[model samples]
Target: MINKHVERANRVITVLFYLGSTLLFILLILSGSINHFPINKFYWLSANTSNIPGAPYDISRWTFWGLCAEKNDKNVCSNYLSPAYPISPKDNFDTTTNLPPSFVSNRSTYFYLTRFDFVFFWLGLIFTGVNTILYIFTFCSYSFTKVVWFLQILASVFTISAVCMQTAAVAMAKNAFKNYGDDVSIGPALMGISWAILFLTICLFFMTGGTFIKKGYKHHQNYVEMSKYKEDALKYQQYMNSTKPINTDNASNPTDPYSLPSTYDEGYQQQNAEKQQQQQPVDIIQKSAGVIQQNPKSSVKFFHFKKTKKIPHNDDGSV
Candidate 1:
C-alpha cells in the first residue's frame, strides 16, 4: 500500500504542475491573438520572402494570425484569426507567381498540417484546464480521483498530438524555405514551450496512473486483514463450542474438574498424572505413621531411640 503522506504530497505536486502547464498552454494560445510584448515574440516560422514575386514583404514571420513583417523598423502582425488557420502562401497572396515550388505543389500538406496543429493545441488546452480544476477535488473523494485520472489521460494524448503536429509543421516549413535558398528558422520560444507542455503532460499521466495502483494495493491489504480476522474468530468459536459442562445431572461426582471436557489435552493429562504420583508417596508415609502410633515399641525403633538400663536406680540405693 502507498503511504498516505507520500500520496498526499504527490497529489499536491501533480496539481501544481497541472496548473503551471495549463498556464503555459494558455500563453501559447494567446501568442498571435494579443501580438504585444511577450506574445508577439512567439511565432512559428520566420523567413525572407523577398525573392518571391507577388510577396508583399521581404521578411515574413508566420504566427497564429496571418503573418508579421517589418514596418517602421518594428514588427507589425496581421489581424487575429480562428483556430485551424491555414498557412498557405499561394492562397494568401492570391497568386501562384514565383512562389516556392514546394509551397505551391504541397499546398494541401502545409494547410492541413498547420490547421491540425492549432486544432489539437486548442483541444489540449481545454482538456488540461478541466483536468486542473478537477485535480484539486481528488483529495475530497475517490470518485473525483478516478474522474481526474481519466481526464489526465485524455489531456496528455491531446497535448502530445498537438506538440507532434507543431514540430512537424514548423520543421517541414523550415526545410522547404531553406531548400529555396532563403533564410529561414523556427521560433525557439514557441517550440520550446510546446515541448515543455508535452513533458509535463506525460509526467501528470504517470502520476495519475499511480493512484490506481496504490488503491489496488490498499484493497489487497484490507482483504488480507479481514481474512485473518475471520480465521481467528472461527478458531475462538470452535474452542468455545468444544467446551461442554460436566454431567452435573449425576450428583455422584460433582467435584470433578477434569470431567468438563473428556478430550483432555496431553499437557493437562500429564499434569494430572504427576499430581497422582506425588500423592502416592504421601499416602505411604501417612499409613506408616499410623502404624507406628499403634505400637509404641515400633515407634522407638522407627525414631532410632536407645533403651535405658534398670540397674542404675538399684545400685544407687545399695551404695
Candidate 2:
C-alpha cells in the first residue's frame, strides 16, 4: 500500500510541476509594471476624463485592486472606483463612471513578494529557511544512522508548514484587498482566476518536497539494515577463518579433510572405510597372479560344479 501511494505521489508531482510552470509563466506576465494591465488608475488619470481605465494589475493579480486605496482618495494609485461627479477633478468619489478602475499590472511577478504580502509570510519564510538547512545537512559525509531520518522529519515539517502558510498568505492578502473600502474591486474579477493556478503550483511544490523526504528516509533505512547484515556476516567469516583447524593429512591423502566441516567428521571416516574395502579386491587378484607366475604348473585344486537330481513325487504303488 505504501508503494502504491509512492507511485501516485510521483505522478501527482509530475503533473503539478507542469501545471505550476504554466501558472508561473502567467504570473510573470501579470506582475510587471508594464501596460499589460492597468495596475494603477492614477498612472492613467491623464488618459481620459469620461473613460475609467482598468486597474493597474493583470489578470493574475486582480485581487490587489484598491488594496492601497483610501475611502475618498481619487488620486490613490490602486483605487478601483470612479471619481465623484459632476465628476470634478477635485473630488475622489466616482459620480459618472465610464469604466471600472484597476490596481495590478500583467507584466511580472515574484514568489519572494508573496511572503511579504500577508501575515503568515514571516512564518513561511522561517520554515523555508529551516527546510533549506535540513536539505544541506542531508548530504553530509559521515555515516551516522538516523541522522538522515532526523533530517527528513525536519524537512517534512518545514515543507508542509511553509506551503500551508503560503497558501494562507495568498488567501488572506486577497481577502484584505477585496474588503478594502467596503467593496469588491474590479481587479479581482479579471485576475482572480490566476489565484487558482498559483495555488496549484504551490501544492505541487509542497507535495514533491515531501515525497523527496520520504524517498530519502526509506533509502536510509535500507542502508542501516544492510550495514547490520554486513557486520554479522563479517563476524561469521572471521570465526570460520580463525577457529577452523588446518589440514595436516592433505599432503598424504588424495583429498583434503580440512575442507570438510567439523560436523562431517563421521562421514569422512566412513568414506575412508569404503576406500579400504575397495582395495581388498585388488590385493586378492594380485596375490593369485603372483603365485601362478612363480610356478608354471602350480598344483591348485580347481573345483567343477555338477547338477543334482531330485526325486519325483509318485502316488501309491505307481512309479
Candidate 3:
C-alpha cells in the first residue's frame, strides 16, 4: 500500500520539479536576477521594483520598447537586473558606480534590520511566528517523502535564521557607528547582509510549497492502495462464507448473494452421478428378455405382423 503512495509521490515530484524550476525563476527575480533574466517576467513590473525601494523608479518606464538604447544596447534592461548601478548615463541607474556588484539583493533589508530594537523584536519573535506556521502546514499533510519534505522544512529554518542574523549584524553595525561616530560605512555592510537574508527567504517560499505538493501525491497513492485492498479482502471473505455448511441435500435453500460460494465447478456432474446410474433400469429389462432361451413348444411365441395390399383395376365384379 505504501508503494502506491510512493508511486504517486514520484509523479508529483516530476510536476514539482517543473513547478519548482518555474518558481525558482520567479524567486530569482524577486530576490534579484539570475543571469540577466528576471524569472518573474510575467510580472516583471512588480518584481523589478523589489530591491530599489523609494528609488523614484517604475518598471513600466523601463520597458524594452521605451528604453531606446536598442539592439546594440542591453544596458537599459540590465540596470533593472540589479539594485546597484554602474556609471552608464544611457541607462536607468540612480547613481554612478564603477561596476555592478557581485550578487543581487533587495535593498529593503538594509533599512529594516539596521535598527537595534527592530532586530531583537522581529528576529526573536516575528520570524518565529512564521516558522511555526510553516511547520504546522508541513505535518498536516505527509503524502510527500520525508526526505524532500525535510529539505523544504530545513530551508525555512535557515531562511528565518539568516533573517535573524542579518538583523543582528545590521544593528551591531549601526551601534558601532553610534559609538565611534561616523568611523564606518554601516550602509554598505547592512546592504550586503540584507541580500543574504533575501536569498534565504526566497528559498523558504520554494522549498515549503514544493514539499507540500509532494505530500499531496503521497496521500493520493495511499488512498488508492487502501481502496484496492478493501475490495480484495471483501471478495475473499465472501468466498469463505459461501461454503459454510452446504446442506445441498437441497439446492434451493435461500441465502444472501454475498454469502454465495464463488468456486468454479469442473466436477459438478460427478457429484450427481448416482442419478445417471439410477436410469439403467430400462436397458436391464431389455437385456434380460434377450438372454432367456426357450424351446419351440414354450408358451411364449414370436409373431410377425402381415402387410395387406389392394388389388388394382378389378372392373368385372370378380373377387
Candidate 4:
C-alpha cells in the first residue's frame, strides 16, 4: 500500500518546485536585463553622461518598462530608445541612434545575455510548464506512477540544463564588466533573485529525482517477487503432472506380487475343493495302519484262542 501522507508531501513539493520555476522564468524574461545594461552602476554611469534632455534623475532605479518608454511631448529624455546591444556610455552622445549616447558596446556581453534571455530562459519556462502539467496528471492518475516518474526525471534534466546555461550567462556578464571604472559593480538585485530562485528550483528537482529513484527501485523489487512466485507455481504444477496416479490395470494384475484380490473366482474355488477331497482317502488309510501297529499283541492272542477251541472238539470225537 502507498503511504498517502508521503505521496501528498511529494506532490506538494513538486507542485511548488514547478510553480516557482515558472514564475522565476517569467520574471527573468520580463525584467529586461538582457536589453539594458547588466550592472546598475554601469547604467547609472551611462545615464549621468547621456545627452537625453528629460531622462530620469536616477536611471539606476528605472525598470525595463521605464527604460523602454517612448518619447512624449512632456519629456525629451523619457523616450530614450533601448539599445540593440549591451553598452556602457562614454563621452560621445548621439541622439539619432537607437542605442543610448556616449556608451561602449561589448559584443561578448551581448552574446551571453542574448543566449540567456532567448535560449536558457525559454527552455526553463517550457520545461517547468510541462512538468506542472505532468505533475497534475500524475496526481490525478495513481496507476501511471512509473510513467510520471520517468517524465519527471526528463523534466528535471531539462531544468538543470537551463539553469547551467543561465549560470554561464551570469558569469559572462560579470566578466564583461570587470575592467570598467572603479565605482561600477556587476551585481544586480534582479540577477541575485533569479540566481536564488534557480538554486531553490534545482534543489527541489534533486529531491524529486531521488524520490522517483526510490520508487522505481521498490517497483522493481515487487516485480521480481511476483515473477518468483509465478515460477514457483509453475514448478509445483509440473511436479503434480509428473506424479499423477498409477494406472489401475497395472496395479491390479494377478501376476504382480503386490496384487491383493478382493474376491475369489468360481474356478479357483472349485480347484481348492477338489484338492481337499482327493487328500481325504489317503488320510483314512494312514490312520488304519497306525492302529494295527499299536495293537499287534492283542490281535495274536485272539487268533490262538480260536485254534484251541477247534482242537478240543476233535479230541472228544477220538475218545
* Runs in model 1 lying further than 4 Å from the true structure: 1-5, 71-75, 223-319
* Cα RMSD of predicted structure 3: 16.7
Error of 3 at 246 (Å): 13
Candidate 2 wrong stretches, greater than 4 Å: 1-22, 32-115, 118-186, 189-194, 246-319
User: lDDT score, residue 157, model 3?
Assistant: 58
The per-prediction CA RMSD against the true structure, in angstroms, equals 9.2, 15.4, 16.7, 17.1
What is each predicted model's overall lDDT from 0 to 1?
0.76, 0.40, 0.40, 0.49
Q: Where does the lowest 10-residue lDDT sum fall in candidate 3?
A: 64-73
Rank candidates, lDDT, best first: 1, 4, 2, 3
Which parts of model 4 have CA positions greater than 4 angstroms off? 1-4, 32-106, 140-189, 246-319
lDDT of 1 by residue, 1-319 (tens): 5677887789789988899899889878876676477777877888887876766789877776567775543346765245566667776666776677887888988888788878788888988899889878776666777888788888888889878877887887888888878898888887888899999999988988898667657767999999999997898679768766544323224366435344456796577667667777887899999898898575644355689966544655873
State TM-scores per candidate: 0.68, 0.37, 0.31, 0.51
User: Which digits, one per residue and each the tens of the lDDT, describe model 2 over residues 1-319?
Assistant: 9988877766555455444444433342233222333333221112122233332322212222222232232223333432111112112222324332221221012223332332232333333334334433433432321343344344334434434543443444344335433232333422333344345435545554555666668788999999999997897788677765745334235566554444435776678567667776887899889888998577475875799997776777455
Candidate 2, residue 252: Cα displacement in angstroms equals 19
Residue-by-residue lDDT tens digits, candidate 4, 1-319:
3687877887787788778777766665554343433322212112222333343332222222223221221112334434332232221232323333112354444344434444544555675676667767654454455555555555556556655654554454344333332122332555565565567666756765666677678778999999999997897678557665533334336686433333345686566557657776886889878877998665545344444434434555763
Error of 1 at 246 (Å): 10
Question: What global local distance difference test value does model 4 have?
Answer: 0.49
